[model samples]
Target: MTIRLAAVAAPFGRDLDECFATIERLAFRARSEGASVLALPEACLGGYLANLGGEAAGPPALRRDGPELARLAGIAGDMVICAGYCEAEGDLRFNSVVCVTGDGILGHHRKVHQPLRENQSYAAGDGFTAFDTPAGRMGMMICYDKAFPESARSLALDGAQIVVCVSAWPASRTDPAPDLADDRWTRRFDLFDQARALENQVVWVSSNQSGTFGDLRFVGRAKIVGPGGEILAATGVSAGVAVASLDLEETLATARRSMGHLRDRRPEAYAAGF
Candidate 1:
């Protein structure tokens, strides 16, 4: 079966209402385009700007069981919506990606690797997990977590055919000005996407935040990569949605021809190292 997927780019600093409006618009557009699932950028609901003072000063804007979830559930009818939000589980705060369908909230993934200023605002998740859905077995990782190959590999091993990544990657220069032939700004995440796609042989769908938030500007290269490391659809540096249709049968064929990594194992050698 062919599953239509949408990678939605969300601009920064948008409030919940504004974000919902944007999502509704995107959802409508996706539905028109025959998309079954829409994936929104990281921190799409509240904003990616981590207010250090705000986390400590007062209560969070939306808790996991708050009205926001109900609103999201309502917004997401039959189409599956995978979006990012701050999840508060009692005293523990986590940067989380939630999947909502008409049935209500389907799954929640807490980011395992927190980067830079996020360490101050969110706690890292302990274990990797995936959820079975009508579309397929879906898995999620937030922003910086995608940089690690093990994360996607873990999801692929868990029978996930498509892995969705929600990111608010900052355009702030982490390195000094370098002389490069190509655009260095995009190279960082591009390599991550290619590596993850090639290694896992699973469709990698990444939705990133665009525009500026405070001092940080977001990188807006949202894209979908196929199991063979081919770019299925890509959104340039702008706020828009990129849609692509993925075939599980094709992915299974690729996996079978490529020695079926899931079936072959060298785990004993790796475990011996541990």
Candidate 2:
């Protein structure tokens, strides 16, 4: 079966209404293209403006069962939607991805690898899990998690054919030296996406936040890569969605045929490295 997917980019730090309006427009476009699911940028709902010291004073933590989730669920049609947000559960805060459908939120993924500023605002997730959706078994990971191959590998091992990544990657960081030049940065970013797709033999879709947040600027290179590490579709440094059609059965066949490495594993012989 063919599944159409979309990756949507939105500016960070926008209000809830503005964000939802953007989502509505993107979802409409995706639906027009017969997309079965649309994946949106990280922290798109509340903006990525986290007040570390004031998190305790912020409004009560929003849960998957909250009004916001219900509102999103209502907006979703037959297509599935995935987006990132800050989650509050008791005293702990998490950087989370919510998978929504017409029925409501299907499942949530707490980011396992917290990056620099995130550690001050959110707790790390303990484990990874895949959620069954109308299209296929879907898995989620946030920005920094994409740099770790194990994250995607775990999802693939768990039977995820499509892995969605939502991210608010900083455009530039003052503390971490200057940002990599545009060409270098783009190459590095695309390499990671390609690596994830090739290693897991699964489709990789990423949605990233765009525009400047303070001095930091987001490199909006949202894209979809096929199982063999081919770029199916990509977006520029502007806010938009990249739509592509994916055939899971064909992808699986390709993976199995090229998995000579999988059949020739020597894991037991490599214990000396450990």
Candidate 3:
């Protein structure tokens, strides 16, 4: 089915009320633009860590069944939304993403890979899985998890037609690029988004935090990528929503018809662990 998809690049901070307000506003705008699915940035609910290390305070840990998530579902209504937050399971906290609508939760994923000192803040997830949503069979990952090929591939293997990656990625701290466009990290972010989609032959939606938080300056380049890795719509280095409309089945079929990546996989040949 052809549906409009949107990925948002916006700032979110510690205030719970402010975060909800931002979500409500973004949801309204996406609905007005005919978007059936929306992807919001990682840690968009309670905010990301000020810095990756040195005992910086982390975002609030919320439960999967918390009232905050219920409020998010109410805002989602009919439209499907994938949002990231710090999840609390007893005393263990995880960096997690949840897909929801008015009917309630559709899917959830905790980040499987930790970058830098991120592991200090939250625990890693076990594996990847896809679940049904109004948009399609969708999968979710948070930030650094997308850097691993296996993460997206596992989701694809599970029959996910669409994958949403939410990130709190930042520009380089040491060798600061005066222009964010020239930042190598920004290039990596875009490259990973494209490469993951191309490799999996699945529609990819990428959302990231914008502006600055504490010591980090986020690279805001939210985008919607087609199955062939072509960028359908992107917000560039700004805070906005990148929206695009296309038939999911048709696009996937066209991309896979000649040489399907999934169909051609030689899983048994690569068992040596290079």
Best by lDDT: 3
RMSD for all candidates, in order, please: 2.7, 2.9, 1.1
lDDT of 3 by residue, 1-274 (tens): 7899999999999998999999999999999999999999999999999988934568988999999999999999999999999999998999999999999999999998998988898888998999998788999999898899989998999999999999999999988799997899999999999999999999999999999999999999999999999999999887999999999989999999999999999978887651
Predicted structure with the largest TM-score when compared to the true one = 3
lDDT of candidate 1 over 1-274, digit per residue (tens): 9989999776845467887888888888998999888889988887875443334532244687789988887888989989898788777778888998978888889899976666777778976688887788889899899877789888988888779999988664555233321346667777788778777778888899887776566668888888777888988767888899868777657656857656776787685633
Q: What do the candidate models score in CA lDDT, each in turn?
A: 0.79, 0.79, 0.94
Prediction 3 global C-alpha lDDT:
0.94
Q: Each prediction's TM-score against the native? A: 0.90, 0.89, 0.98
Which candidate, 1 or 3, has the higher TM-score? 3
Error of 1 at 185 (Å): 4.2
Worst lDDT 10-window in candidate 3: 265-274
Candidate 3 Cα errors over 4 Å, as ranges:
54-56, 272-274
State how far residue 1 of model 1 sits from its true place (Å). 1.1
TM-score leaderboard ranking? 3, 1, 2
The local distance difference test score of model 2 is 0.79
